[model samples]
Structures are given as C-alpha cells and as structure tokens.
Target: MSDTPPILVVDDQEKLLRLVVMLMNRIGFPEVEGVTSGPEALERLRERRYALVISDLEMEPMDGIALLREIRADDDLMNTPFILTEASFDFEDINVAHQAGADAFILKPFDMAVLKTKLKQVLNSKPRKREAPVAAESSLSNDFPMLGKF
Candidate 1:
C-alpha cells in the first residue's frame, strides 16, 4: 500500500461523495475514489484492490446492506475493511452490518475526527482467517443466499 492505501467511497449523493473524497485527501488519504452506486462500486472492486470501502447506507438499486452482504460473501473481499455510513442510525441496521463483517459504521454529516479514528481502528485490525463455522447458528446462508457456504 503506497504510503496510504486507496479508499473507495460509495454514495448516491454527488456532493457528499465529493466532500468525503476531499476530507479523506486532506486527512492524508490522497488516493481516494468515489462511486455513485453499489453496482459501480462492485465493478471497481473487481478491477482493483482497496484498503477500505466506506459506503452510504442508502442508495439506488443496491443499498449498503446489500453491498456489504455481497462483500462478506466473497472470500477474497471478506476481510477488507468496510464502513457503512447513514444519516439515521438503526439498531437493526447496526446488527446486520456487524454480522456482515463490517469493520466500522459512521454517520452522515461526516466527522473528520471520527472518520480518522475509525480509519485507524479498521486499518490496524488484524486479518481474520476464513474458517468454516462449526455451528448451524453461525451460518447466515439460510436467510441470505449471498452469504451462503461454498
């Protein structure tokens, strides 16, 4: 990762995306890229590797929850740090995000300090070895096909 690893920020709002990119750059993450939708983000994810992915929880077509689930399902992207940002905080949303392997969750109207802190926490996190669950409750495949076992 060159100096700072590249970050991919996904948000439907163009202004928010721009602002996030600016803030990330100012905070020493110069190699930041923004996408307007989950599909677009997935395309980019296929093309390159990113140190982190910060996505808005609400978006057209595929929302952050769907995106996060897909990311978690893929073995290659499963360990990548994912941060979900939303304007409103919901406990159900938080639970799902955490279960989906999200590293951090941030609120909208981004806080530079909080963002920085979360970035550190996520980056410093050790890689988790992908191990199959021994218990039935550990598998989320029964509900979410994307999160199913191989």
Candidate 2:
C-alpha cells in the first residue's frame, strides 16, 4: 500500500464506517481512513491528500451532497474524486449528487467487489465538475452494472 494513495470514508454510523474501512483495507487499500461526519471529512481533506472519498448520503449537519458541493466549491479540492453511497435508491437524491460533482454513486449493502469496482473506476477517471442533472437510472446503470441487484 505504500505506492497506493490513501482513501477517506465518511459515515455517521460508527459500525458502517468501520465496516467500510475494513472492506477497503481488504480490497487492497490499506491506507483507508474513516470519519464520523462531513465536517471531519472536510478537516481531513484539508489536512491531507487522498486518492478518493467515499461518503454516506444521509449524514447530519452535512450530507454527502452538501459535502460534495463544498469540495467542488473549493479550488484546491475541486478535482477530488468522490463516490456517494446511499442506503436506499432515491432518484432526487441521486440527481442532486450528480449535480454536486460526484464521480460515482453506490447503493449501500454493497459487497467488497462492488466497492472495488467503484474505487477503480473513480480513481482511473479524470476529475469531474458539477454538471446538469441526467436520467438517474440510466446514469447509475451505465456506471454501476450491479446497481439493479440492489
């Protein structure tokens, strides 16, 4: 993991956060960091550079969409790759995340293989900017082949 970039994961649920961190480690990302809130995520982002950020969609004070927007607004962090994860499929929420510059979206209860795919896709792609909303279902299916299973 010395040559690999670190990953940051944000989820308010402690158990979920730890689970994700563990899965990321198991999937070849040994330098995974977990934070409990968006504010803490922002603090970490400002403090260090990360290869990617995977955040839960429903956190308080600052949800994933809000955090993405904040990251996009900042010139220094505007190009950071981000993946937003939600427990349930909500079209409106997904659309908002797209508009906020999320690199990818994953529905929760995902296995390690699904997470590995998303991490690879996001990390290999160029940085993205906030864009107009698109058809959420089509966008999700195109990006995540296993999305229909959830």
Candidate 3:
C-alpha cells in the first residue's frame, strides 16, 4: 500500500460515484477509487487497502447494507470505516445500516462541508489492527439474494 490513505466510493449510480470521487479528491484524499456495484466494490477491496469506504444504501443488484455486512465479516476488512449514504433519512434504514456495521450514516442531499467533516473524523480515528487474511474469497451465498435480480 502507498503512504497516502486510499478511499473507496461505491454506488450504483455512475454519475454519483464519479461525483464522490471528485469531491474526495478536492477534499484532499490522494488515492481514491469508485465502483458501481457491490460485487465490484468487493473486487476492489480484495485488490487494495482503503482507509475508508463510502457507499450508497440503495442500488440495483446489491445494496450498501449487504456490502457492509460482507465487509464486516471479512477479517481483512472487519474494522474498515464504512459510511453509508441514503437519499432518505428513514430511521429504520439508519437502524438497519448500523446493525450491518456501518461506521457512520449520512443522509442524502448532503452538504459538502458536512461530508468533509465526517470524512476527516473517520480518517483521523485510530487505525484498526490488521487481521489475518481470511482467504480473500467471496461466494454468492455470502451476497444478498436481491443482488441477483440486478
């Protein structure tokens, strides 16, 4: 891994993904990557080490909740800071995301300043200890069923 912290942005919307990438760059994250689906996000995770993961809660095949669960279960990514974003601020949605292991939840139509603040907080938090690799293997069974529809 490079000295600069890597950030991963995951969303089904291509435009939003690009926008987040641009924003992170502007906000001073030197290394950033964006992906459009949960599977693609996992692929990226396996290939690199990221300091933070910002994902959208809703999507076609796999949602952010499912992605968060997978990340939490993986020993390598268990402590990775994950921020879940949603257009709606439904309490139930927030609760679900929390249960799935999201480090923070941000409502959509968000202000860049707020996002920057949250990013800084998460990035500044104590780093998690690296765990032994758990094979770096993912199976369909581990993925949410709804993801297949997409």
Candidate with more favorable, higher TM-score: 2 or 3: 2
> Considering lDDT, where higher is better, how would the candidates rank from best to worst?
2, 1, 3
Across residues 1-150, which tens digit of lDDT does each residue of candidate 1 receive? 477668999999999999999999999998999999999998898888899999999899999989988888888887778989998767677657767777777877878888898888888887866686334345444422334463
Per-model TM-score on C-alpha atoms: 0.84, 0.85, 0.80
Q: Cα RMSD for candidate 2?
A: 3.3
Cα shift from native, residue 48, model 3 (Å): 1.3
Q: Which candidate would rank higher by lDDT, 1 or 3?
A: 1
2 versus 3: better lDDT goes to:
2
Which prediction has the highest lDDT against the true structure? 2
Model 3 residue 59 lDDT score: 82
Judging by TM-score against the true structure, name the best candidate: 2
How far out, in Å, is residue 25 in model 2?
Answer: 0.4
Worst 10-residue lDDT window, candidate 2: 141-150
The local lDDT score (0 to 100) that residue 135 gets in candidate 1 is 41
Error of 3 at 89 (Å): 2.1
Q: lDDT tens digits, residues 21-50, model 2? A: 988888778899999999999999999898
